[model samples]
Target chain A: LAKTTQPISMDSYEGQEVNITCSHNNIATNDYITWYQQFPSQGPRFIIQGYKTKVTNEVASLFIPADRKSSTLSLPRVSLSDTAVYYCLVAGGSYIPTFGRGTSLIVHP
Target chain B: GAGVSQSPRYKVAKRGQDVALRCDPISGHVSLFWYQQALGQGPEFLTYFQNEAQLDKSGLPSDRFFAERPEGSVSTLKIQRTQQEDSAVYLCASSPPLAGASNEQFFGPGTRLTVL
Candidate 1:
């Protein structure tokens, strides 16, 4: 499993774009980047995933550079509801995964 | 329920007692997984089942923890002789297992187990 590195917390204002970056310097070639959002008392929800380059979904965007050494999760027009802990999943081969402490994004009014 | 469902949303167990938690995966999901989440920490993989077969259980902390997905849909996690450290949120996720691809996992609300 590829160990992930991310900030412990970040602050963002409402209607602003919030970006959280994750560093996986040793990410495997077969590995993919996935992001999950979790609020209090709720299971983490899948936000977006990407193998390389830029991938956009209805909720967020994931940008992975060519080397795949790092990736960024971009949330556009953030709202109070978007405040949650965001986890980056750097999956390796096989059936298991390693999840590290995610970056908690606090959206303030 | 349309999504993955876990019963007894909250469970408080005393030390040395046994506790059983249930999970119902999505209608057609072929893969199920169990995870343990400690306070302020990300979820840790506990086990994984492909249909009715338990493929990997290396993540389970000890033999005291047992999980079964007999029919491949509904599963149960039984923790015997619970300890204070057993207190945590147990999460269940299900997805379709594919070859050489990333299967997005759909998670349940989770069962918060507190052992006193």
Candidate 2:
């Protein structure tokens, strides 16, 4: 499993764009970058996933650089409800998904 | 369509007692996973099952932890001799066949266990 490093926490205001970056220097060739959001008293929900370059969905966008050493989760027009802990995982092939401590994002009104 | 479901949303157990948690994956999902999440921490993998076969149990904390998916639909996690450290939320997730390791997982609300 590839170890990921991210900020402990981040703060943003309503309508602001939030970007959280994760570093996985040991990422394997087949590993895909996946992000998940977890709220209080709830299970983690999948946000977005990408193998390289960029992938966008209705909720968020995943940006993976050419080297694939790092990835960023970009949230547009953040709202108070977006406050949650975000986890980054690199998994593929036979490797099981491993979650790190995650970055807690607090969206202020 | 229904998603993953877990029973016993909350449980309080005394130390040294045994406890069981159950999970129902989405219909036709072939991959089931069990995870443990502590307060203010990300979930940790406990085990994985492919259909009726137990594929990985390496993440289980100790011998006290056991899990099974006998019929390839419903799964159960059993913890014997629970300790205070065992207090955490047990989550279950499932993925469709051919989803592999990187696919998105549908998660249940989870069972919160508090061991006194």
How well does each candidate reproduce the native contacts, as fnat? 0.58, 0.73
The i-RMS of candidate 1 is: 1.9
DockQ, every prediction: 0.64, 0.78
lDDT of 1: 0.92
Q: Tell me which residue pairs clash in candidate 1.
A: none
Clashes of 2: 0
Top-scoring candidate (DockQ) = 2
User: Candidate 2 — what's its lDDT?
Assistant: 0.94
Off by over 4 Å in 2: none
lDDT of 2 by residue, B1-116 (tens): 48999989999999999999999999999999999999988999999999999999999999999999989999999999999999999999999997677899989999999999
DockQ of 1: 0.64
TM-score of 1: 0.97
lDDT of 2 at B16: 99
Candidate 1 lDDT over residue span A18-85, tens digit each: 99999999999889888999999999888888999999999999999999999999999999999999
Docking class of 1: medium
